[model samples]
Target: MPKRLTLTEAQQQMLDLPAELTNEPIIITKDGQPVMAAMSYEHLTSLLETLEILSDTEFAEKLRESMAQADRGETISWEDAQKQLGQ
Candidate 1:
């Protein structure tokens, strides 16, 4: 779970958190209501990329199909794939 901190407390200790801890979002609250969230750049980028993929209908369908195929063991060896692609 992400850590929760008051706005003032976040300002004081956000930067002091260990690098591993920063991977999770830090929920900042003001007057006991959530006001903002902070996360590492890498985490933000990954979320954005996932959002992009999910928002594209064709790509998302293709991803689901690919995952289902893998689950069904419909996969080729890397060398066979490379050969098919003439790589």
Candidate 2:
């Protein structure tokens, strides 16, 4: 479960909370309404790494399709490509 703290209480406990619950997320609230959250650097990095892996998988699938088209002679040669680019 996420730890809950009022805005004022969060300000008071911010320093200690980081160390006390380094593996969990803390939810901060204003006027009893949820506003923001604080999580450990490790957790944030793990989330970013997962997102990168997912993006790479998508890119790889697209690259495979392009390669298949090229192998089937559906792609232009480098010289032709250069001419098309007016290079």
Per-residue CA lDDT of model 2 for 1-87, tens digit only, reads 888999899899978877956778888999999999888888889989877875897787887899899899898889999999999
**What are the per-residue Cα lDDT tens digits for candidate 1 across 1-87?**
778989999878856754645559888899999999878888889999999889999999999999999999999999999999999
Model-by-model lDDT, in order?
Answer: 0.86, 0.86
Q: Candidate 1 has which clashing residue pairs, if any?
A: none
Give the TM-scores of the predictions, in the order they appear.
0.76, 0.59
Residue-level lDDT for 84 in candidate 2: 98
